[model samples]
Target chain A: MDLIESYKEDLRLIRRFGTGFWIVLLLIGLILLPWFAREYWVYVVTLIFIYSIGIQGQNILIGYTGQISFGQAGFLAIGAFTYGHLSLLGSPILVNLFFSGLMAGIFGILVGFPSLRLKGPYLAIVTLGFGIAVYQVFVNSEILSGGRMGLTIQKLQPLFGLSQMTTYYYFNFILVFLFTLLSYNLISSFVGRAFIAIRDNDIAAEAMGVSLTRYKLLSFAISSFYTGVQGGLYALLMGYLEPNMFTFLETITIFVAVIIGGLASVEGSILGAAFVVMVPQVFSNTKAFIPVIYGVTILIILIFEPLGLSGRWMKIRLYLRMWPFR
Target chain B: MPLLEIKDISISFGGIMALSGISLQVQEEKIIAVIGPNGSGKTTLFNCLTGIYHPNEGEIHLNGENILRLSPDAIAELGIARTFQNLRLFMNMNVLDNLLVGRHLHFRKNPLLPMLRIRKEEILHRKIIEEIIDFLDLQAYRKARVADCPYGVQKRVELGRALALEPKLLLLDEPISGLTSEEKEEAAYRINEIRGRFQMTILLVEHDLRIASRLADSMVAFYYGQKIAQGTPEEVQRNPEVIRAYLGDD
Candidate 1:
């Protein structure tokens, strides 16, 4: 018991102080990443950050509200289109991005309102239809969206005078940090609790005076907004936008990032994003065998650890933490 | 008129009648217990009151407003709160969060205000949250996860959440059915405490006859899907139909 108590004390200390230290350490590493790594690795890190933003939104929707959305990518496209179109019209990058996200939020509210009314599989199908519809809209809207061929997106200039990769690297890094911190705070607040209440048991939550319809719609709106921001960022970073860019496959890719990382965990999103972005490149050398290996590995994870790689790692960590005393 | 009146409420599922022309009036600030055997439609009545299942026939009035047309959440907004027969506490949240969620309907502020860190909204939210935490003596578990808590504490947490709404009328469906005798005593104390301390009106649905007799001001007994007897606790206890239906024989 004494050993357990002592261990708990250490765990508390780690949670309280260790997190700050690690965050600082992570910032330093991220800052230095461009110094040692090539342009390709920098690209990979950017992808991770972008994917993590979507994963964070998914975490809120799935983890707290227990509402599964397969249409986050569609919202992302709306955001991307809003930003890309506005920037092409010579709007400032930040303004374009912000308004793009807001625009996505409007669509989210639109999609969320009806989707929330439906239950389970109905909700999924509706959102799935949304993704397909958006893809089609981008394809058929030739004059505005540039049809299937795509358009070159405007590269956002640095907020400062520096035009170097260093400045852009740091800017993207800040995006990741700000997004993570905001997501964390929102998920830990009263609104977050309401989301969890709805998720855990809606009937009980309603009795406690939780407005299920409003809050369920709110989750969809919020998640869609974040996913929208991610879409805007994707367009800016790629210096391009196209119908082909946002696809049905991208929705599955978002799922892979979140589920493989950890469904409800923020760190899992980051880890999953990094893994998803990096593994494809590393396996590029293997070529033929990579897809088979990837498929089998994903199948194993689904069968053995539906909670994802982070969940498995957590069990190991718990076991290690409980060693000796156990 | 009584504080809450349900008149001729009938709800049917396909061909089966869940509740048929059930009507009851609850006077203000009274401990009214609804007791019945299984499948007597006791929970179905609670569901109708809370707007879970809309009645095919009848009207419910709260404070002279027709609540039958109100959605479950709308009914809740009109100062009515409830607890499920099945322990339906937000099981994954902390004690404080559980109570905080209860104030969702009461805390009416623009969602954007909190995100913007609007000082006034934050202050009001914090004040409510603190008040609820203090009321429940849940300050200790404010940061603890709900999944780790025991069943009894979870029950109390659910009660705390309902109390957070500051409802004029509380509908507790089987608040003490699954509790131990010790828990039943505790539950009875809490119910009395709310009545005495908060001066809140309560309608309890319980299986424990002894608990009912001790806590209730009046008792309403149901057989099948209709109310067989309702009066002062002593009057209802002595009612022959209640005795035959519940007390077996004397």
Candidate 2:
């Protein structure tokens, strides 16, 4: 009985701390996995990190501010290309990634400024148009985008002095950590509150002295900037760039990731990114109808778990421990 | 000097005229109420004064300068604050933070400064924080979320948020309309105390004749977007146009 009571109390601590506890535990497991799990899982893990960066950007715009952008894949393409092209020209990896992210953000600002005047579906259409335009440019521009042939990037000079699969995993993990922290800090701050305020009521936000147009435009631009930077990192990790890599469906995935992970949540982005990137890859070897299976699974999750898997887990944990109170 | 003056202001929403030519003035440290029947453009006139709507004709001078062209944000910076007819509290935010946001014009810290203000201006003791919390009696429920509060509390909280701006002129849209008798009385007490405490030049739009007469020093009555009467509460209440236009009977 004493041992069982101790065991239950330990489980309770883990349940209460929830996402942070799980993420930290997962990070530890991931850091150790490269030693035992071999090459393929490492690749899949790297993919998860890269996807989280994309989701992080989406989280900023869609989750926090309640703005939808169909141009997300376009922003992703900009990051990938900027990084791939700069790296090809003999620039260092860090310099290329930083500049690429910066350029993508500026691009976001330009597009966001004029089109943001229209709300909701109109704004989504404008961003979709931007995606289509970028797609056209990517297909036609042989010199810049390498046309349909795609650009094969052989190497990226690592984030720090670290190397090998384990090092790469840690590096990507840290990047994801930083992204989550930045997002958390942003949400907790006046700017984040302002975004929620704007989302809640634009008229009231303005009456309360928030500049609606300015902040709306800035939120889009900033969200894109974060996504763009992630794109550059992604190109480096994949060791290639292709027009097909960023599709409209992928933009949908960005939204799906947040919604499924738990919209307006940092941990939700990570969980969504992981599920989106991993589940498909894990079944990729099955070859015949693996992608179809993944799609069905996602639909099931959407139907029954509107708050997403993370939200469901949170409720279950609460139910188990504090049942009567709940 | 008069705190606010609206000259022959007019607004047409597409083909329909919402507010026809209307004019009114509010003196410093006085409670001036605007009473009207529904669709008489009471809210429209308030919207124009607060820069939510731009009048097609004439100008509104705030503190002796035309504020007709100013945006809502610009009007706020010029020391004008307002409460919506429907409460628009940042429901997710804590009660104190809602008021703190109203002190936006005073905040030079940008968004970054609020984090640093605790250390940077250790001496300021967060002046607005202390004063607003005290003035509105929001001390007990400072940390409570606005969404969870009762309606009467939310109403008071909205007023507290507006007063946080420490504005020279406050445009209150029916501050006591939907409240029960007790709540209305509480709001009336706060209105009197606020006026006495802050020396605020209040422009109140209300439908309740009793509350208006008891609280307001003067009243401006509107009919079909036009000012029909303006004088002391008793004088305007006596005006036949006001009686027929807003009072409907008696």
Best-performing candidate as measured by DockQ: 1
User: What lDDT is obtained when candidate 1 is compared to the true structure?
Assistant: 0.78
> Candidate 1's residue-wise lDDT over B154-234, tens digit each?
777778778878888998988887778887887898898888877788988888888898899988888888888988888
> Could you tell me every candidate's TM-score relative to the true structure?
0.90, 0.88
Q: What's the true lDDT of residue B231 in model 1?
A: 84
Estimate candidate 1's RMSD in Å.
3.9
- Single out the weakest 10-residue window by summed lDDT for candidate 2 chain A: A1-10
DockQ of each: 0.42, 0.32
Error of 1 at B144 (Å): 3.9
CAPRI class assigned to model 2 = acceptable
Residue pairs clashing, model 2: none
Chain A: TM-score in each model: 0.88, 0.85
**Model-by-model lDDT, in order?**
0.78, 0.78
Query: What's the chain B TM-score of candidate 2?
Result: 0.91
